[model samples]
Target: MKKIFTINCGSTSTKVAYFEDDKMMCKSSLTITAEQLKEMPKTLDQLEFRTNQVEDFLKENNLDPKDFDIVVSRAGTIPSVPYDGAYEVNELMIASVTYAPEAQHASTLSCLIADKLVKGLDVPVIIYDPTCVDSADEIAKITGIPEITNMPVAHLLNTKMAGITYAESMGKDYKDLNLIIVQLGGGITLGFHDHGRIADWVYDDEGPMSPQRAGAIPTRYLADYCYKSNKTLQEMRMYLCGQSGLVAYFGTQDVRDVEKLIDEGDEKAGLILKAMAYGVAKSIGQLCVVRGGNVDQIILTGGVAYSERITEWIKEKVSFIAPVTVIPGEREMEALAAGGLRVLNNEEQVHPYIYYPKGYSSIEDIINNPNELA
Candidate 1:
């Protein structure tokens, strides 16, 4: 039987699991608090620390890291790759992620951790559907700003797997279906999968408000605030991506706490949550317009999809577009394992990681940028 080890690193936690063929053998997670994060500001600085934690987890679970025939992980900050699939971890990929100072996320450590786990062992390390996966249609890449072509970046890991899961359930291939995947979590994004390629996607700041993300805000107002409010770019990012949304209103990031507040007759909390759902519904309606209203399925999957309140609200609004499938939680481990199993079973070819620092797969060859920015 083939052995697979999956690693999923979030902002504050590292989740690792072991699998034999298709059956999971053991799983564990190591969590770090905000205080702990503050001690190590750089994402790569925590690499050795996280890799050691994974080794400890293996020891505690009586699973040897050396015994892992294949190691797969959630990709973090790689330069934009053209397609979605598994890519073998290599020096180019590692250096691209490590050197990208502006894009250092805690999740970026997962690739480093995956690389470290099989240092001496001849085990293959791969990452499935990284954040940089760009399979959107060429027209979708264009925007008002030329240099700032919005490359397809969303919750590719969970959402793509969810699409495949729903497709198989209906006895259809993922590439043969027109689907809209709604990824609701700490960060919310929607992707319009036209047959196989991700035709387009709604990004972080242009979608519904997540539990933490502020989502789509007025561009004119945001620009005015940036100039008048005297907040730095980093501070503004923290506001929109970290301290905004439900947390900005309720002083908490957990959806469960927000639900409790709603249950306790807090009209304000209830209103905000409902508004979030309303925004999600509106976003789904927008994506349906991508293919001229020929959506086959709409799958709501992610950590937040488990919420009956939000899902029901979205369902009431988007059920008319297509049949909605609720596949709650980010099944990244399973997806990673499946990707590894494909490599092991020779069902798919694994590509070597290539770095494209300025974001590859541009729709147009010539995009003017006098300042050479973004």
Candidate 2:
């Protein structure tokens, strides 16, 4: 039996899980503070304050990275277009995430770990969704952003993990059933997975407005707001995704704090939370409709979905669409390890990732379009 070590990096934390002989033997999650993030550690010393506990846990468990057969992870990205799940990490992924046009701190950590592991270990290291952008040309043209066609299916792993777990719990294989997974994060993402593939997905550009995110706002209003604030497009984006959303609305990025305020009769807090739930329901409805309204279940995941209130609200909204199940916790690490195993065993075929220019759908469009860069 082989041992697999999975690492999942996020904006403020890192999660590691170890699987041996077909079972998860240990897991560690390390949380980091905003100040710690601001400093941007360039080495393991910089990561010390945050990961000291994790290092200690590993030491206590007598675990060694070198012992693992493979180290797998989900890499961060800049949003683009439609992509299928599963990919092998490459230099393109490394550069995209590490030197992303946008300053994505999560990507920084992923690269740091990837570099460290590949150099230190003899095992194979796989990054599934490292800033993948594989979009169809048609959608890219509509958005007028050529980079929109770069589609990385990062979410596929987590959604499928949730779906399979929920299905197995019900004595079924996910391949035989259709599932709609509503991930309530800074925004709400509705995805449909059927027969072992992602059929369709719709993400609220405004998100479910989390404790740290302001879900989608009216584009016009946002433009006006940015104008009034005299913020550039880059700054506006940073605020929209990183700062202004939930933190601006509620003064805290922790959903638990917001929920507490709501419990304390904070009307504004309650509204934002409800708004997120409504958005979630709406997205789920759209995905269900896309799947001909025969979704077997709606599985809710992500940080925000942990709240009982949010889950119940989304449940109420999706009750008519399908029976709803809330599977909290992001299973990114597990998915990566399992996916690596599947790919290694040749039990599944990894899809070829195609990076199409922003505005074209097919080869013809790319070749014939008058606007195409010559």
Candidate 3:
């Protein structure tokens, strides 16, 4: 049996799993407190510390790193890669994550830790379906302003895995179906999966509001607030991405707590929850239009998908487009393990990591400088 080790680093926790082929033998997670994060402000700085945690876990579990044939880590927000799949972790990937504009996420340490742990072993380290996966169609890239393009960034890992799982359940090929995947969690991302490629997606920051994210708001109002609110760029980002949504209105980021308030006859909380679902349904409707109304299955996954209230609200608005499949909670770790298993079984090719320089303002620029992508 081929042994694979998978790691997924979230903002506050690191999940490590040992898999023997398709079966997970052991799994563990380490939580980093707010104090620890405050001391190690830079994501790359936590590399050695997090790697030590992984090593400790391996030692406690009586597993030898040398026995593992493959190691896979969740990808961080690197420079936008045009393709998706298992990417061999290399210096280019490490540099891209280390130097990217928004490299503050804990996931940036994934490849770094994996690289250190698998050294001197005949093991391959790979990162699968990073958050920056960009497979947008040409038309999908066009924005209202000529100077700005609609970049593709979303929850590619769980969304794509949910789609593939649903396709398999139907005994259909993932590459032969049109799928609209909605991931409801701390942030919500709605992706239009056309056949196999992700034609377009609403970036979570710009899509439906979630438990912690503000999602989309009126642009004119946002610009005015930026001018008058006297908040720094980082503060504004925190307000929009981390402290907004339910927390901004209800002072709590937990969806279950909000649901409890609703159950206890809080009309306002119920209305806010319904409004979030409505926003999600609206985004689904828009993506259905993007897919020309030929969606085969609408898949819902992530933390909030477990809530029947939210799913019912969304279903009422979108069941007309296609059948809805709810695969509750996250499948990210399993997805990483499955990707490593595929590569181990020779079912998929592992691609080399290459960094594309920033500042390509137009499609014409990309067309003109083909070697830049190389």
Candidate 4:
């Protein structure tokens, strides 16, 4: 029996899973809090801290990395997908991630975890269905941003994976069905699925002015505020991504807290909650347009999807679009493991979805001239 380890590093936590013969044997999620961040190692020193944590967990559980046939992870966004599905994290991909960076705490953490595993055991590390920026040709043309590929493709991939599992249980292939996937998480990612492939996706930049992010702010208004007010970039970022959303609207970002306030008849909280649900419903509607109004199922998945309040609101709004179902949490670990095994089994090929900076012909060309920009 071949064993595979799927490592997922979320923005706030790390999830490790062990799979044997495509079956998830064990899974663990270790959350890292702000207080932990204060005492935790910086970027360069994080490898030891991450490694020790995983090593201790495995030892206590009587498991070893050597037992695994492959190691898989969720990597950062590269550039653009040449096609679709999963891919391997090669030197080119790694270099691209290292050079042209984004706010990818999970991807960086995953690298540290993978480094530890590869050092202890000579296993190949693969990344599955990373944020594929494969915007439809028309969408790109409309957006006028060549880089604006479908940002929610990864959500679509995982949602489709879940759909297949659900369909298989009923002795049906997902390929024969049309589906809509609602990803309610740190952000809302909606996708239209046809025959198990992601046909189109619509995502809200930030989450609904939830307890966390300020959601989508009008760029012009934001710019005016920045100009009129004297605030540092960090301050603005914190307010926009963290404080302004539900916290700013209410007193807290916790959904439970918001719900409590709503139950207490706090009119303001009720309004905000309704607005968020409305935004999600609006996104679902946009996805329907992509499907040409032929949606079979509307499935909801993600961390926030667990909220009954949010789910109910979505269901009521999109009922006519199709039947809506909620699949709480994400399947990134399973997706990673599946991708790794696919590559190992020759069922998929590894390719770079991102291009090197400096507009170079290849990764080697960029590497050979590090001073090109200079």
Q: In model 2, which regions exceed 4 Å deviation?
A: 41-61, 78-86, 100-108, 129-154, 344-374
Name the Cα RMSD for model 4.
3.8
Per-model TM values vs. the true structure: 0.92, 0.79, 0.90, 0.83
lDDT of 4 by residue, 1-374 (tens): 77888877654567888888688988888676756655652332344666667777787778877777878877664565645666566667665555443443344557547755776467777676666646453552245466653344445546766787667766988889888777666556676677766667664453345556677777779889988877776456545754576767765656888888889989988888889888888877877877688887888887787789888987899999888877787777877777777777878887644555436557776555543111
Q: What is the C-alpha lDDT of each candidate?
A: 0.83, 0.64, 0.84, 0.68
Cα-lDDT of candidate 3: 0.84
Top-down lDDT ranking: 3, 1, 4, 2
Cα-lDDT of candidate 1? 0.83
For 73-106, candidate 1 gives per-residue lDDT tens digits of 9988666888788898886666556654236466
| Index of the highest-TM-score prediction | 1
Task: Arrange candidates, best TM-score first.
Answer: 1, 3, 4, 2
User: Which ten residues in a row are the worst by lDDT in model 1?
Assistant: 365-374
lDDT winner: 3
